[model samples]
Target: MLVVGGITRLTQSGLSIVEWAPLMGVVPPVGEAQWQEAFDAYKRYPEYQQLRPTMTLAEYRFIYYWEYAHRLLARAIGVVFLVPFLAFLARGYLRGPLLRRLLLLFGLGALQGLMGWLMVASGLVDRPSVAHERLAAHLLLAFTIFAVCLWTAADLWPTPAPDEGARRRLRRLHAGLVTFGALLVLQVTYGAFVAGLDAGRAFNTWPLMAGGWWPPAAWRLDPPLRNLLDNIATVQWIHRTVPLLLLLVAALLVAGAWRPAARAGGPHRAWSVALLAGVLVQATLGILTLVTFVPLWLAALHQAVALLLFGVWLAWLHVATRARLAV
Candidate 1:
């Protein structure tokens, strides 16, 4: 879904759908009349008027199908989740906290859909693009759903037993991981901000921006704090800087988790290492995406890697928590 979203955004197809019809939207335009109706409706939006005024019916369908498929996939995910969920509930498959967890996940999924619509609506008004903040929210919420699913899945597996002392260490390790996860979420959110502002296109040079290590205009946005989130240079700088911080934290996390005392009793040593590797891969992809001018393929890969990294982090947290609780 996110890959398609990246494509939609890159192709400038997101605003092609002028309305949010979750139920009826399941079936796209089936005939020329319907297609024309859809296109005519889209023509009412500012994007078509200002940005793609010359778009023909075929051109409109080109963009429309991407957004349509994106929406359809979202709806399918909901159904995919709901039917099994109800069946599992009826069969007592989801019991105790697991049921609550699934419900919470479902709610988040629902919110994600709403956020997508909110994002799409952003560009329907005066602007030809979605509000960067809303886009970030949409992207973050999608990851949140993915993280919740991973955490839930991790719960279904057995955890290694840890002695009391190791449990204490694991607790600390879990705390660190949780903190690291929070930071990752913030980093990704800011990354969305970068994508939203198209900040990646601003600094074509790696290890530096526009020939300087620190671009002069990075902090030029009024209200220094706003610059951190809104300014393209500042956003890109922060996006570039966060990976280094994450790497440091990841190294610390792995080192602490592998301490003789902690290592004696945690889940297999692989989870932490896998997480560190994911971080490295995602960071590398992000840099490549930036230096390469945010090409569609790299941008899509970057987004995919971000999701992968989030999953790894969630897995790490799950394993750590499970290890801490194991007798």
Candidate 2:
């Protein structure tokens, strides 16, 4: 669903549907007259008039189906999740903390649907593009739901009490992983910001932006603070820079955890090592995505690897603190 979203945005199909109709949305316009009606409705929106004024009906269908499929996939996810969830509850299979967590996921999923519509609606108004901040929020919410689901899935397995030596080993990684996790979240949010603002399309060079370290153009917006969110150069520059900082944190984590983990022959250092590698690969993908002018596949790969990197962090953090989490 998330990757499909990347395709939708890349195809400029996000606002093609123009309306949020969860129930009626399932059955897309089928007949020739119905299809023309749907196209007519879309033509009334700013996206059609301003961006694709010459879009033929066949061309309209191309973009419309991407958004249609994205929304359909969302509905499918809800049904797939809720049906089994309720069934398990009725069968007395889910209870206590597990049930509460599942309910939380369902709630977040509902909120994500609303956020998706809000994002699309942003583009339908006076502007032809969605507000980047709202797009970031919507993407971040999806990431949040994914992270929580991953945590819960991991917790379904046993987390036994560690011996004192093992506990001490875990202590070595706890602070580092927590700090890395926080940094990862910030880095990913900036990534979403870049994508939403289409910042990666510019400054198609590595190591510098527009031939400068900070891309002097980054400071163009007034009040410096406003530039943080509204300025494409600033947003992309932050996106490019955060990974370097993340690499530094990951390095420190390995340096701190290596000795104890090797002595104990445990998994702590392995995760730290993997974290570093994941960050490196993701950083490389970001650079390539930019240098290549944000190709769809590369950009989508960047986004997917980001979730995978977060999965690494979640797994490491869970392993580090599972005893406490189990409680």
Candidate 3:
């Protein structure tokens, strides 16, 4: 479901449906008449009228289905999670703090749905695309819910002991991972800005924004802070460089885990290795995404891999903290 949502964002399909009918929209258009109605609604938006004037009914259908499926999957996940959860509660599967946590997770998921709609709503207005900031908020909220689910699931299982000294070190490592993750998320946000502004179409070159390392007239653009947010060159530059910082932090984390004295072997070692590998793959994908001009598949794959990597690091942090507590 996360993968599909990421794909919808990458393909700019979030606004294709033109409505947020959580119940009725769960079912896709069944016939040509319904499809045209959906297409007509989309055409009423500025995105179709101003930017996609040449779009055909077929192309509209393509994007419409992508978004519809994305929303439908969200609804399905809710049912799948809630039905069993209620049954479990009835059967006394939930108790104590765990039950409280479960309820919180459900609340977070609900909030995520609202956030998704808020994100799509931004695009349906005067702009042809969603606000990059709102997009980032939506992505972060979804990932946060996923992370919480994974964390809670891990809690259901036994955890390793925490060494006192190792606990302290792991705390630092966890903090670093979180900081890097936040930066990576901001980078992704800038990627959204780039997409919203169609900046990718302008600067297809790699290793530089254009013929220069920076936009030729970057400083001449908007106000200093606003420029960083809206300037294509600035946004792209940050997006490109932030990942390098993440790679460096990830390497340091792996080294910290593998050091002989740290004895970060066992689960911690395995997680460290996985973290390193995920970051490396993500970096490679980022580069390819740039050089290839952000193809839908590669871009979607890149976003998915990033979320996976974030989950890995998050799990690693959990285990590291537990190992600390045991010691």
* Best-matching candidate per lDDT: 2
Residue 55 displacement (Å), model 3? 2.7
Candidates in order have lDDT scores of 0.83, 0.86, 0.80
Model 1, CA-based lDDT: 0.83
TM-score of each prediction: 0.93, 0.95, 0.91
Local accuracy of candidate 2 as per-residue lDDT tens digits, 1-327: 888998898888998888788898899998999999989998888888898899999998999899998999999999999999989999999999999999999999999999999999999889888888888888889889988898899888776666556665556568778888888888888887887888888899999777789887677788979889989888888888888889999998888767744353457678888999999999999899989998989988988899889999999888878743433
Q: Of the pair 1 and 3, which is ahead by TM-score?
A: 1
Q: What is the C-alpha lDDT profile of model 3 across 100-176, one tens digit per residue?
A: 98899899988988988888899888988888778777877887788888888887788655555766657666677
Q: Model 1, residue 3: what's the lDDT?
A: 87
lDDT of 1 by residue, 1-327 (tens): 888887888778898888888888888889899999999999898888887889899999899889988988888888999999999888888888999999999899889888998999888889878999999899888887877777788778776556666576677778788788878988988988987888888878888777887878777777889897788888888888888888988888888867886663444367768878988888888888877888888888888888878877887677667666774
Best by TM-score: 2
Off by over 4 Å in 3: 163-165, 168-172
- What is the lDDT, from 0 to 100, of the residue 191 in candidate 1? 84
| Pairs in steric clash, model 3 | 161-323, 162-323, 162-324, 162-326, 162-327, 163-323
Off by over 4 Å in 2: 260-264, 323-327
Q: Please give the ranking of all candidate structures by lDDT, highest first, separated by commas.
A: 2, 1, 3
